[model samples]
Target chain A: MKATVHVTLKPGVLDPQGQTIQRASEAIGFARIADVRQGKFFEVELSDDGDLEAARAELERFARDVLANPVIEDYRVEFLSDLPAASEQE
Target chain B: MKATVHVTLKPGVLDPQGQTIQRASEAIGFARIADVRQGKFFEVELSDDGDLEAARAELERFARDVLANPVIEDYRVEFLSDLPAASEQE
Candidate 1:
């Protein structure tokens, strides 16, 4: 199975990178843009035999312990379809 | 409208950050993880009156021209529902 994780800064936290993107858009005449927030995205591939519930729990632990800084960022994990990942054979 | 953009490295591209994450997971006992790829995520808010089709086109252009490096990265844009962005009132 495959899953995606997104780690985004909390609303009140400062994000210079996000501001940079917002400014860049304005510089290029994208006046319609009100805001641009940037974050980290991850795609994780799991073994076919991995226990679904265990993997889910472990993945959440991984996300909190390593993938995200809980003090400043929030994370969400979304499971993808069960299709074999293209990179599995590599 | 709110939309999301994901910028990921194309297959065969070297991803040092992804490697770092993968290694970290292994070191931390996440044996279920077969591989991990890290990418960039963004949340973009457009003005309410913004043209839908035009915004879609502009967003794609913005993603390609500003958010992603076409030579090694691929980007996908997904529009969210029409709910007003929280930051819009700020």
Candidate 2:
């Protein structure tokens, strides 16, 4: 099993990186872009057991313990058989 | 009309941030994590016109000119109507 963890700042939290990127987007003529929020994606391959729930739980624990600061950040875990696809979900 | 641009190091490019994260994963007992690649996911809200193709093309240009170093970074663009979902696609 493979897992992907996306770590991002929780809503209402101040995000300086996001603000900077938004400014850069405007500078580059993406004036229609009103906001930008940047996140980190980690792709990890784990020993496969065909159990998504267990994998999700373990990955969530990993996020809490090491990957993100719970006070300001939130994370989502996804199971992938191989590499993740190149699109963001709707 | 929102667009997402994921920026990652091109294959074979050395990623110091990824290396550091991999080291940290091992230190945290994710010994099964043989490697790690860290990528940036930018979620941008764009003015919607119900046209995905043009939005994607514009985003690709943004990636080339401002969002990433095209020589070392590879990027993919996705269109969304609202904020992106939590799980990564597989």
Judged by DockQ, which candidate is best?
1
What CAPRI grade goes to candidate 1?
A: medium
**A1-87 in candidate 2: lDDT tens per residue?**
657778888989988888898787888687666778888877666654655445556666776777778899888877665322323
Quality of candidate 2's docking, in CAPRI categories? Answer: medium
Stretches off by above 4 angstroms in model 2 are A47-56, A82-90, B49-53, B82-90
Candidate 1: tens digits of C-alpha lDDT, residues A1-86: 78999999999998898889888889988877778999999999877674567777777888888899999999998788743443
Worst 10 residues of 1 chain B by lDDT: B81-90
lDDT for residue A90 in candidate 2, whole number 0-100: 13
Record all residue pairs in model 2 with backbone atoms less than 3 Å apart, i.e. clashing. Answer: A1-A48
**Backbone collisions counted per model:** 0, 1
Model 1, first chain, TM-score of: 0.83
lDDT of 2 by residue, B1-90 (tens): 567778888889987877887788778776455566777878777765655555556677776777788898888877665323323221
Pairs in steric clash, model 1: none
